[model samples]
Target: MTTLIAEDLLLLLLDDVKGTPTSSYLDVALGGALLLELALAEAVHVRERTSVWSSAKVDVAPGAVVSDPVLADALGRVAERERAASDLVTRLGKGTRDALTARLAERGVLRREDDRVLGLFPRTRWPEADGRHEDEIRARLTAVLVQGLDPDPRTGALVALLHAVGAAPSAVDRGGVPARDVRRRAKEVAEGTWAAKAVRDAITASTAAMSAVMAATTAAAAAGS
Candidate 1:
């Protein structure tokens, strides 16, 4: 099966042993990945920032093929008007991780088990169903992050996305990769100008979006308490 950049990212975020997310921001990260795919497809566009790396807004651009509901829904979020990157992240990524997980389950890349934690609250767990595909993803990422090499456009975008979501350590050093080198290279991919102008803008937009969502979530939690 042809793997998507988002799929690769989702695999990295998943635990090989427990088949659970390694980060709390999996939805945001996955959402950001979907937008990146849209940006690459020209289905979405990020307006140039007024300030350096600030106020990067994403808007639906039309003309790009809407392949699936995931991408379609992502486009819908940006359809009305350009919104702050952060707002877009929260809007587009909301509950999207589960959607991606379901798709993966249908594809046989993962196994889904539905149950209740204490015979009360229903819960779902997707365990590692197959390791071959995820292993390929890991190898590709490892070559770029551990070997100090230039990443292809897609891989570069993945790195930036992971960085934006603060999951680089989880991706690179989880399997004994040198944390320092992995972090340094991952940072470059995230902050580097090596990618196309559109991709770079998309990364910036996603970073802003994740930051905005995290801040909002934090504030809301604090207020509730």
Candidate 2:
């Protein structure tokens, strides 16, 4: 089965050697990726806000059949009621990492490693089992973000998600390109006039929501520390 964009994003954020995620805001990014995938699949529609004060509204596309269980579950949740795209990011993304990671492990793209931190706290890690697929994904990202090539919808959507999570600069090797230049390029692609207005609005809402979630998480962690 073809991997979802969310899966790809998770793979990118995960450290291949340590089998741990590089980003703290992974769930938010994963949720945003699912929304974007649903948008691309036409399984859901994100209506543009009618006014500046209104949020982008999300609605399930009637009779949309999502073959993947992960997406199907998200589509079902979306069908429950219309919601602001921003609100659904967290709602739909909740508890998705386990499912996605398990799927990747099942597919042999990753290996499940059960261990303990300091031999005291139990923890699980997913180290790279097969890297060919991730290498291909990185190649595509490099082509667009650093090589200045036009991106297809999937690639464009991936870039937008990476940008949302503030990972675009680190997602790929910059080679000769400056990190700022890569970031600027990602921002341009993310905000460019390539996708439909609805898709664009969804991305914008997801980005805002992702940022908010990340901020809250960071603050909470600091407070706890």
Candidate 3:
């Protein structure tokens, strides 16, 4: 089965043994990935920012449709109305990780385990079941980030999302490369012309939005604590 870019990202976010997310912001990253997928299908577009202070907004194309149920649902939500990319990131991303995880589990790429934490809370975990596919994704990331190869659009978008979520550095083996250099390279690729100009704009907007929300949430949690 062909997996979505979002699926590839989830695989990276998940711990192979722990079956839990390494980052707390999985939804934001997955949401950005979904937006990228919609952009690739021409199902959605990001309105240009009128000013530097303005946020990019995402809107659905007229009559846009996708075959995948997950993408289709997200497209329908986008079709409801134009929204700031940041707002859409959280809105579209709500509960999406679970849906994607279930899909991955169905495909046998992950194994679902249900457990109770101290017999008080219910939880689910998705550990690696068939790692071959994930291995391929890691190889692609290594090629682009470490081997200095240019990325195809899909791989490039995946890198951009991983970088956006601050997970790029840990997603693959650095092969003795310095962490800072790896980060710099990932940033360069995220800003590269691997994708169309419009798509690039969407990616930039989506990632910026995700970052803004993540930061705000972090601050809010800190304040609450």
Candidate 4:
């Protein structure tokens, strides 16, 4: 699943760079890398259960009740958080692509120029044409890139909580720190207190709204079929 998601993301990045000069390949590559991280996070969330295992087999863990509502609610919250992260990933991908195009245009690199000498010049030469302009473009791109690439504090915290409930293994390794401990720390970093609850509520509401839309679309398609 990860491999498929990575390939799909690479293709999307390539499409975004299509028609741009080869000289700008490095820029496109860097942008694509950042985009890929965001995409992976989203993909992980969207396909969390299916991607990890064929079936969610819960071990009774010696005298644990399987029909606990609290446990069920916790599981539901995790799913909702994943859905929200997936939605954010889609939004961020579009925003990043659009921002890249706009920045390139502002830098005058979007248009084809007829000057043979300038055409032969390196990519750095064009940026030297207007240092201040290039700086501004870089600044704007950096700001957007940082925001979208990093995990949202709220969601990250929620993921940490889910890890606790599920006893999930940590994706990152820290020596001497147990996986659960690391996840709990991450949750602390992502959520201070009240904000996490608010974010949880928002995710729950958004999931319901999005599910309704998807169901309606599926039903309409089925009717037509």
Query: Which candidate number has the best TM-score?
Result: 3
Flag clash pairs in model 4: none
RMSD of candidates 1 onward, in order = 2.3, 1.5, 1.0, 17.8
Per-residue CA lDDT of candidate 2, range 1-225, in tens? Answer: 489999999999999999999988888788899999998898888787799888778898888999999999999888988888777888888999999999999999999999999999999999999999999999999999999999888899999999877889888879978999999999999998788877777778778778777888889999999
Model 2 spans > 4 angstroms off: 222-225
State the local distance difference test value for candidate 3: 0.90
Backbone clashes under 3 angstroms, per model: 1, 0, 0, 0
Considering only N, C-alpha and C atoms within 3 Å, which residue pairs clash in candidate 1?
86-209
Q: Write the per-residue lDDT of candidate 3 for residues 5-110, one digit (tens) a residue.
A: 9899999999998899998999888888899899988889899999989888888888887999999988888888778988888887888999999989988999
Listed in order, each prediction's TM-score against the native is 0.89, 0.94, 0.97, 0.23
**Whose lDDT is higher: candidate 1's or candidate 3's?**
3
lDDT of 1 by residue, 1-225 (tens): 776667788888888767788877878877788888888777788888888656887777757668777888878778867688777776777878788888998888899888887899988888888878877776777888887778888888888888776677667534666676677778887888777788788888787777778778779999999
Q: Once model 1 is optimally superposed onto the true structure by TM-score, how far is the C-alpha of residue 41 displaced, in angstroms?
A: 1.4
Clashing residue pairs, candidate 3? none
lDDT of the candidates, in the order given: 0.79, 0.89, 0.90, 0.32
Against the hidden true structure, what lDDT does model 1 obtain? Answer: 0.79
Tens digits of per-residue lDDT for model 4 on 1-225? Answer: 112211222222222224332222222222222322322233211222354323211111223222323223323334343233323322323334344444444555443223344568543212122234333423332232222233444234333222222221222324455655655554443334434343433333333333333456568889999
Off by over 4 Å in 3: none
lDDT at 67 for candidate 1?
77
Q: lDDT winner between 2 and 3, please give it.
A: 3
lDDT of 1 at 99: 83
